[model samples]
Target: EPEVTQTPSHQVTQMGQEVILRCVPISNHLYFYWYRQILGQKVEFLVSFYNNEISEKSEIFDDQFSVERPDGSNFTLKIRSTKLEDSAMYFCASSEGQGSHQPQHFGDGTRLSIL
Candidate 1:
């Protein structure tokens, strides 16, 4: 089966630096999303993209953040300026359809560390 893959299972960065997390979404999926989880917090949705445009985004998705589908299979998240609070487990998820009822498959995660 096709599965999402994320690079650098763990990332360590200094505050005010930049970080670009990479993900390869499952082939044949239409909607892609990015979610994050603080060490002991609930999963939070950052943004969702489809058809080369942003479909929905949360307040957490501020100007410092951006996402792109560089190619047919690669999806990337760029944190233009990182902060200590940005430390968390970043998950890359995808769904088959556009409805909330559709289940999303998530990658293990990329643990971003900012000091």
Candidate 2:
């Protein structure tokens, strides 16, 4: 089975600093996404990328956040001017199709803690 993998299982950053979270999605997957779950909160959708462009995004994914396919094997989320509220478990997910019914494979996630 294919799997999505995220680097730096845990990350600590000071407020106002910039942090980049990285992920490697399943090779065969065509769609990629980023989601975050704050402590004691539900998993919230951040952004979705396809065809080398952002396909969809949630309000939580403000200008401070950006996603990129820097290379063939990597997808990254850069949080500029990080804030304390940004602390969360950021998960990378991938799917073969864009349909809502398609199952998404998720990574273990990078635990981001803003100090």
Candidate 3:
């Protein structure tokens, strides 16, 4: 079965620092997305990328956040300036097609800790 893979399952960083979370979704998937969940809070959508461009984004994806697929395989989320509020489990997801009808597969997630 195909599955998403995330690197550095856990990361620790200081406030004001930068952090990058990485993931590799199923090879045949066409749509990729980033989402995050603060402790005790519901998951929030961050951004979605497709066809090499941003297809959708939530307000949570601000100037401090960015996403990229630099190698055609690995998808990355970069937080330019980390804050205490940024401590959360970031999830990477992918699907064969876009829209709510398609099943989106998610990675285990990367827990980001800010000091």
Instruction: Score residue 53 of candidate 2 by CA lDDT.
Output: 98
In order of appearance, the predictions have TM-scores of 0.96, 0.97, 0.96
Give the top-scoring candidate (lDDT): 2
RMSD of each: 0.8, 0.8, 0.9
Kindly list the per-residue Cα lDDT of model 2 for residues 1-115, writing each as its tens digit: 7789999999999999999999999998889999999989999999999999999999999999999999998999999999999999999999986688889899999999999
Q: Rate the local accuracy (lDDT) of all candidates.
A: 0.94, 0.95, 0.94
lDDT per residue for candidate 3 within 27-104, as digits (tens), equals 999999999999999999999999988999998899999889999799999999999999999999999965779988
Q: lDDT by residue for model 1 over 1-115, one digit each (tens)?
A: 7898999899999999989999998898999999999999999999999999999999999999999999999999999989889999999999886788988999989999999
| Shift in Å, residue 114, candidate 3 | 0.3
lDDT of 1: 0.94
Instruction: Name the runs in model 3 displaced over 4 angstroms.
Output: none
TM-score of the candidate numbered 1? 0.96
Positional deviation of residue 63's Cα in model 3 after best superposition, in angstroms: 0.4
Off by over 4 Å in 1: none
